[model samples]
Target: MFPLSTSINLTLPIEDPILKFLLILVIILAAPLILNKLKIPYLLGLIIAGAVIGPHGLNLVLRDSSIILSGTAGLLYIMFLSGLDMDMSDFKHNSWRSLVFGLYTFCVPLGLGILAGHYLLGFPLYSSILLAGLFASQTLIAYPIVSKLGIARDKSVTISVGGTVITDTLALLLLTIIVGMATGNVDDHFWWRLTLSVVLCIVVIAVLFPLLAHWFFKHVSDNISQYIFVLALVFLGAYLAQLAGLEPIIGAFLSGLALNRLIPRTSPLMNRIEFVGHAIFIPFFLIGVGMLIDYRAFFRDWESIEVAAVMILLITAAKYIAAFLTQKTFRLSKDQRTVIFGLSSAHVAATLAAVMVGYNVILGYTPEGEPIRLLNESVLNGTILMILATCTISTFATQRGAHNIAMGNAQESDDDRSRRPEEHILIPVANERSAEELVAMSIMLKKPRDPNGLYALNAIDNRVEDPNVEKRARKILDAAASAAAGSDIYLQTLLRYDVNISNAIVSVARERNITDIVMGMHHMTPAVPGIAGIPVPAGPAIGRMAADVLGHSNITTFLYNAEQPLSTVKRHLIVVPEKAEKEAGFQMWMNRIHQLARNSGAKIIVFAPASTMPYLRTFGRRRPANIDFVVFEQWDDLPSLEHDLRQDDCLWFVMSRRERVSYHPAMSRIPLYLEQYFAGYSYVLLYPVQAGPGDSRYL
Candidate 1:
């Protein structure tokens, strides 16, 4: 039996690495659950739990090198996720606003900090300036709260992230300069080295990382390999930043931006990233932050009390002033202003680093044999209290703001949605390769809120005596389910016993009330003998199986042929029929195309007649601004489009069934033209839903 007394060692805190890791994992799992009942935020709970178990509390664990390493990663992960989850379109549109906010957030805190440090604390010139720098720097500690509240894609959040980029960069630069001056490293050579190194690092991360990531993602297919590749890039970028005289968090943020377009939010890889961060890294980081707090020091003396009070006041007031000024300039709502204040108020990451540097820089010796550093032990203790206070304040402010914004959005969305159709999409899986591709396409096309809508159908041949038949079908369904789950989309798999695959699909669609069917152009036509006995397709490009499905299918259908990764496509070359707007599913197809364009961050180039331009532009105005229209009525001459096709473009051909409103005699020849001219290019053949009067709107 293990002796409880033997485990207690006054000289060491959990000496065994395994035991330390086990304790941390248990805390990560249990702290949130235990604290949740008290109506406390899980993030705060993690922090408080850390303080209780730390060396200063019950002394259960020590702040070791392993803890520091993980905490650093968590800090960087916070910045990385902020960038990765940002809506690029919104960020691009509000770049100027972000710049303005960054300046306000940095200048206000910095100015106030210098004054407070000099006047209130009676610090010297360099110490005052360094304290000011700490005030200007902030960590996005409350970012997870907003993300949890589902407002991560809000315009306000985008502005906050952009502003964080600018302020953190500036704060780090300021810290570097102050440290160089104090350490006697400030010279002409230092200036030149810093400038050149910073420029080179930016070029490597901003220009080269994206290219490498694109190449890697395009070539590598395994999900695990792709995730590992992303992590490697993040850490490498962080190390490069440290070498370039910048914080590693900046490198991690840049790395996230470099790979943002490659990883869509609705992807499985993104899901994995978020899961690992929230489950392990972030909690470890929060706990480490709590461990930094020595609560006893807060009441040690009058100087400690004064320093804590001044530091906390300056940070909270300066950050709020900056946020207020920005809000007035932008004419934003109170909740948005509050979010900015809360997000920018916490001073944990850079403040800790700067304080440690100040505490270590020895200036003189006192009578008590205590070394007189640039920042004394009282200041160090004050910083710890400030961190705890500001973190708690930011959490409360952020949660209040986020809750209000979410409720406001819910109300607004309800008002705007006049008629919502109960949309359900059905995707039939036959093979692993096509299943993944089709599931990705379906995720982009389906409605985000309809949880019970997406379905994957698998057909098993009853006549086949082979036992592997059911096994193969189950494998296909599993692959499809995995693909959808990555994007947080649920795919209900249905297995049917039938020799006729198309018939099974139709029956499932009818039973499930599926509104759309996304299929692949995998079936090929049977070959016929040509003049020299060489084979040629006997009928149209699509095989009999596809033709039968299209003939019998009653809902909207999409037939996709992918020659390259959809996420890498640069432009969507949309070819709309002349009378497509007259069809019942015109708006639905337009919405689907827009969804795909937004997900890929690709521009839409529509090639249609003059009559369809007005309807197209009207719809385009409601989405992201990246659509270009070309007035071309000769779409029936499909082979002529080969000149316009590029390697990075996707062709979207909008077609109609026979006797439908948009159908023309020329539509019958499009499949043959596509096979002959656009054989190696990605393309989508969309057959819109023939919706009746009762089912005009889609959910």
Candidate 2:
């Protein structure tokens, strides 16, 4: 070591702080726009810049400040922005597939990581568990990426987003417990403390946040100050978590989620936060990470290259298997299933962050010291390699595979072809709106890809028993078959004595294992006592009786208006409200839209309101512009609130505040609004609460 300087240079001038800050600001301002124009992730550019200017490189502007403050703030912002996107209403209703995928995401790589760390890599038990934890945490970045790729409106997108949230949350929780143990802080009372912490977090979120947020929003009308309110909450929650000796990221996440239920999905504050984080904090964090990358380490350990390759395959396979097993009843086409697996396989920042925290904090190993922390260097390089390779391969394969399977062009492999069973498509014909909606979905599914070997079936349900019921059913079926170009069509017209339409529909679905159910919805009411003595149900609505029977299954329900002439839907929008019922009808709407778009080859748009305000700082700053449907709670004349969305040809769906489900009293008034927009060539759909035992009771 060099001896301390004997002569002190008392007159040495210190670097100007403002000038240093300005230099970074100027570089960041130009980095993303210029680099993104070249088709690269802006984060990549920032990372390179930080690495060059950081101490290991030029050491241009030496400062005593730690990167931790900046990085932690950025990480918190990212997590909080993620929380703003915690719209699980769609997933809860249509999430069996995602749940299956989520579990696979958590377990597969975790087990593999543990094995790799302990047996192959010779790591300690705690360290091995930490490695497993790293693999378990996947980023929820697919939404933004897919949105940029122009597929944010796809059903696959919803499934992926929902699945990531579930899997990541579970992984984080597990990691937290392991960290506590690894840190030797888990004594006899550890369980109780952990339990209490979790309970308190949940209770604060479930009971306190909503009430507080509502009070704040109601009383505080200033737009700028509203953001301050959100920050106050974030700071308070983060501080509280620190006081409890837990990760502040958890508190930030919970605070964001608590507000998710209370704030509007498209609040200006959420948008502003996203922008700030994306523009400043996130880039800084990524750059800092890049600075930490040691290229020389790659040359030092050739074995690491092989480990990365093997780890990638194992982790990918594990996630794929876990998701595949849980999706037994999802009825996903082979291609969609492949896409789910492929997309779910990508894990990057989250994994690295977890491992870094574990190695440095839990294992007591520093990155720059001798015996250089392999946990940081090896895992980072390995993860980046895996992410790049798998993301590319999966994206290409999934896109093409989904296309082939959807189009029915994917024939059985030679081995399976010998034992191939006949495949069929089930189409339920409708003469009313509800039936039309369901049929429209079939059209949507048809639009995406496969067109051959397709079949349609018409179900004629006349309540009265008739000797010629079979003949009448065949007549309707034949007409539908003719319309479908006579493609191996099958018709089932059953004459039943039961007035309960739900029983009849369910019976047919179960017996046939129908690929999809298409139906129409119209107002059903008592007709004036004209010449007919029997009252009829208007629209295709089988009514709550039928909906209740079919609601529990994995079947997808598509509703349309049969009264309107059947035509391809070119553009469709899915509305998602912030506080929608657990079984919100958004999934059904999206499924129908996807089907329609597939058939018509039309572009679909998905939009959701930002959950933050414009002026206030919170988390993520970039608003998703790709999804066509906008998720909003209520629409008003406020120019600052959703005022930019006044374009014509837009469809709006209002969630009824009065009714519990589609059968509620307020549902009756939907037609009034529908008629107003119908004439303008803008279809306004009213997606009332679905028939279920969910949050509808509160609404």
| TM-scores for the candidates | 0.91, 0.49
> What RMSD, rounded to one decimal, does every model reach?
4.4, 20.3
lDDT of 1 by residue, 459-545 (tens): 876777897888898999999998888777888999899778877887888888888899888545565332211112555556555
In model 2, the number of clashes is 58
lDDT of 2 by residue, 1-699 (tens): 988867643321225555566767877888867876876555456656765676545665332354556666676666565565554344344567567666767777788889988898777777677777766666533323342233433455457655665676666666677777766777879878877876786677556875787667655645468777877787677666655545566677678767764443323344466566767776666556545544444465766676567667777777677557644556665656665665566565566556656646635435665543425456656665565555444545455544454344224334433663322235544332233234333443442223342334444446646777667555655555433332212333333333455556656666666544555443434432211111223432224542443443335444444332223222445443444433455344444444443333333454444541221111112222212443443433112223333323334343433233322332333444344334333344434325444555433
lDDT of each: 0.82, 0.52
Q: Which lDDT value does model 2 have at 379?
A: 60
**In lDDT terms, how accurate is model 2?**
0.52
Question: Once model 1 is optimally superposed onto the true structure by TM-score, how far is the C-alpha of residue 171 displaced, in angstroms?
Answer: 1.0
